[model samples]
Target: MSADEKGDFISNNHQVQPIQNSLLPIQHNPNDALPSSSNPRRNPRNMQGLLKFLLETTKNEDGTHDSEFSPMDEERKEFLMNVFESMSVNIAEKLTESLKVISQAVNITQQDDPSDCENALEVLTDLVDEVDVANDFMKIGGLQACKPCLYSPHNGIRWRAAQLVGECAQNNPLFQHNAVQLTFLDDLIKLVDTDTDERVRVKALYAISTIMRGNEKAINFFHDIDACHTLMRALQSDSDRLKIKVAFLLSTAFSGDQFLKIQLQKMGFITLLVQLIMEALEGKKITSLEHLLGALISLSKDLPDALEDCRQPNLNFLNILDNIIQTYKDDSACLETVSYASSIKQMVYSYTDVINADR
Candidate 1:
């Protein structure tokens, strides 16, 4: 056909009517000739080709692509969603197997060349983050599927695994209760204090934080195992990122009880925290300063007495508060410090009223 004729056929003069008619169920004539394979009852290859074309057109190198009217993509997404919706033992077992395969791939890649190890770790990390995969894995045994990866030679894999474990430990109480092995906590503590990889250390700190918050028994175990000191040592690390995470974890611990806050205060954590906050403010690292401000707020709420004690004859608490209020008067973060100062002022006023009343 000529180009113009082809265009006309495609646009308006096509034989779509015949095709639609053929798609309708046919009533076979009893006395007619039998159908031949040339015109087979149904052509599987055509259907397969159509499906392949739809899939390829709607997918990119990275993954599935968004489409406006792609039925195949929609069906595939729905199928995967349904598979994830069914939470059963069988599904958990299958996810465990998938994680094992990814773990093996990570190890093999790390051994072949350290350079490619990061790609493998990224793949493993993505796999662990799959909601069905993570949910099922946690159901089967939290951290069990990922436990082997913790010892992988590549720190990236170990770090990602620690983060996944932390997420699981935080959200699933059963996993938290069942998975409290001394070796696990000790390994996490070691990573927090001594891991050469900064990301690994951060992940380890988060995992420790999750464990601390998951169960009261875990908290007691951490203190009994002397993990708190390890966490404290992390605060002294040169990395500000590490310091921030350490501060956050310690803050959570403080919010749990007065005794924990007092314990941290006794360990001289407040001094380090105040210094960190001051340094962040002076350096004009606004994000770090904001985090430090939050930590300070928590400390102030939990250990007001300890903050009060920081006020010496030469360095008064009220004077420091006044300085901070003036320095950050326009900043939204300064509001936290302002609120704290206002609370302190109200308390003092109340005490003075009581004293006057007694007089």
Candidate 2:
């Protein structure tokens, strides 16, 4: 914000609250695994010496297995790495192969075997999850290979392509910067605006937020556009996944910049968020309400003056907080909702105190 509007106005904020970077977990069905004719649990030795070799790696230096050991330990990594290599499917090797396969698939029968493309995409998504692998991915033209899939008619392929970009760029400044150079920002924005598939839209926005989060040029580029309105439409969307992500992205986008918060407040973001919260509470379920509440707390944190929007008597912010706390307190799943609700309740209390002191 210190820079001129036409100049570089955004950069990294090391103090920005860390986003919980995660992909929607791929639910690997046991049936999806490559199966064998013999059941290993019934009898270990039936499948040759493979089972014994696995157990041998777990043996400690004293020749007794460390029953409490976890895979995170260095010894386990060194011992188990050979087992992974022997399986002939090292992740880097297979993931590189998959990148080529998808590129070729897109060039060939894109429609004939969507499952093959989708499966290959899912495999590459694994590469994006790890930083080192993500680097290797970019070095080998992973982004260009993925571009064709982004336009695939299959919804699964499109969403997975977006997810690949989002996962690779999250919390990674170098990747974020490169994503901008490759014009991923423009493509992702267009994807969010026009994609009919809700999953695709959500992942596209996820990638956009990550790319714009800390990079100066990317954020400056976005500043000239209707970024707030794009977010507003997302909040008004029917997809709970989209709304939750948009809410979290608010914090990421607004942090370390009062000018941005002022822009949001002017754009009626506060009023819209209140309406969304009330709608979620008045309905039968409030699963995604937690993120909405967190957004409010983030946007209003440490403000010199409480928002006039929050002080509206008709909105009754305190009552809403109380209802959320009471309803979600005992519900195990909404525990985060309760905590965020409590934080905002205290925020509202502080707001009220400031209002009364002025009176």
Candidate 3:
């Protein structure tokens, strides 16, 4: 009876234990704290966890601490460094290749809902933040692919196209050199001067400013076209964004090209700016006062002949300048505006023509 009972109980217990084990939830291994296996996100700068894992694997128990870490451990460290660096280079290349593929996929023809084109442009817009990626994008005919999109009936496509151009051109001399060519520059100016969509106008102006800012060849390109006239059209556009962007470009984008500055002056930019500043002073809606003030200061410095335009009593430029300083002297948010306004007044005061002028 004892043998039969014991044998039957043992066999049944084994079977029941197997089923229970299968039904139980698996335990989590704390050692699996690494980021991922399918898409690893290891930080090269902060790889203490990986180093610790490698340390554990490479440790020699031959003499504990004495032989725990040897020359082989240093070699392993160098190998790990090389692996991470190679991985970084590979990731960058793959990312650039993905951008290239996506850029070529943006079809320029009319799409009922060009959201695919828009989404792809958005991806290109973000990825071009890296200089090498941007250079790679420009090298892979990304701009040529994007050119027709600038004329897409869809506003999103148009604006995103211009924005991607700007992203590629921003602080990128290589892209600017490629972008400042005649066809591209003409297209950008057309958008800035005539695009019905304000978003397109703003981004086109952004692209233009980025391309034309620091490049002497770009400035010469501007002179060849009616680029100054294009900018003047921007000043008059109903788009406040265009006005602000124009003002910003005026302040910082002339690249000390005296001819362009004098061209802007002769085109009555001083009078136009005076009108804008007066409107701002009168509380008529206008762009950033700081930017407007900065543009005027830049003009006065760059175009000496502009001082007479600023002094035109018909416009009452001195009165407007005083009003600006008084209005903004105490305004914390308008420190830049006040500084620029005061600079203009100080510059005028230093002139022999206005030395006797009333405060």
Candidate 4:
């Protein structure tokens, strides 16, 4: 089924029905001709008249009410769809007006009133939601709309935008190219390094992880651009959230193509990867430990190359593999670890056979 049909089906299934007989016709209210003494300062008659007019206008021409309501509802839904479609090309323009209104309100309040910040937050949130709606309509365009919000003046806005970007990047590998082309990495790195808001920085780190995950080109690009050091620095940030995100990114990169992995290892990434795993083990940051272990397993798959690059003998690598096998011999909780150990053993044994044959 088409996306629109699916959306409509879901909407119809989840929609709440309006209360029966709740809509009173306009111009037929008993209080239209009466005046209230309790509210001398208020104009109750005028209010009643206005509500009556609205009710009457909403009624069908055939004297049967709600006959036209479904068509009107469908029209409104179509208009909303159009608005979402136009969001990509017109987001910057629409946001300009919204930002201006927010800034004007903030200026009037002079930052003295909490309500000013609340209003700004509300507008910013609506803007982000609109962008997300657009993304659901057209993925790439919606991502573009959210890109500028990463630099928004309000920390809350920046954090939300960063999250949206990461979510978009995670959904499509093509978004990885768009993200990098938009210099998303530069913005995220700056946020990671200089942003005073820890939440914003943490979210930026997550965006980095999302952009890198399952994206070989992005990993190669980062390796070629020598951004691994900056990424590693983020792993050392005080925020455990940022550290975990950075570790995941690194682990993903390490598990990519051998060329990218070798490039990163040549740039001294293996040491950082090992250090991160050790730190995670010690600090109980088990969130990405399995991913890290999988990355290490991939690295171990090419043990001969790593040994040669590090100028170490194959015997040394075998000894490390032996230790791991012994440690996870009967540990049920470490099933993944045991599987990795078995793979490492196989790689070592294969290498030894080849070496002896050459000799």
TM-score of each: 0.61, 0.72, 0.70, 0.52
Q: lDDT tens string, model 1, 1-359? A: 25643343235322211111111112333343222335422211233333443564445545365545535578556644443333212333334455545445335545455434444344434444434444345444335546666767778677877887776566545446545643567778778877789999999888877767737766665555266687667767778888778777655754675566667667766666666655665676655655555665566564666565454333333444455667777878667655654554343334654355346
Full-model lDDT for every candidate: 0.57, 0.70, 0.70, 0.55
Q: Write model 3 residue lDDT over 169-284, tens digit each, in one string.
A: 88888678767653677888888877788889999888888887787787777675387888888887666778889998888877387887787888899889888888777874
Off by over 4 Å in 1: 1-94, 102-110, 113-135, 139-142, 300-305, 314-317, 333-359
In the range 1-359, model 4's lDDT, one tens digit per residue, is 35653454335243222212111222334644322335322222333554554455454476654444444578545644553343333444443444444433323322344344334434444444332332332231344445556666667667866776676566455556667766788888788878989899888888887777776666665654446666667666666677666656655655657776666566655555555555555564555444555555565456455534322443344444455557656867777755764664464456665476346
Error of 3 at 338 (Å): 0.4
Measured on C-alpha atoms, candidate 1 has an lDDT of 0.57
Query: Per-residue lDDT for 38 in model 3?
Result: 62
- Where model 2 places Cα greater than 4 Å from the true spot, the runs are 1-92, 105-111, 304-306, 350-359
Q: Rank the candidates by TM-score, best first.
A: 2, 3, 1, 4
Q: Cα deviation of 59 in candidate 4 (Å)?
A: 38
Please report how far candidate 4 places residue 68 from its true position, in Å. 33
Number of clashes found in candidate 2? 0
Best candidate per TM-score, number? 2
Error of 4 at 309 (Å): 6.5
Candidate 4: residue 346 lDDT (0-100)? 68
The better candidate by TM-score, 2 or 4, is 2
- Candidate 2: residue 122 Cα off by (Å): 1.5
Q: What is the lDDT of residue 306 in candidate 2?
A: 37
> Roughly what TM-score does model 3 have, to 2 decimal places?
0.70
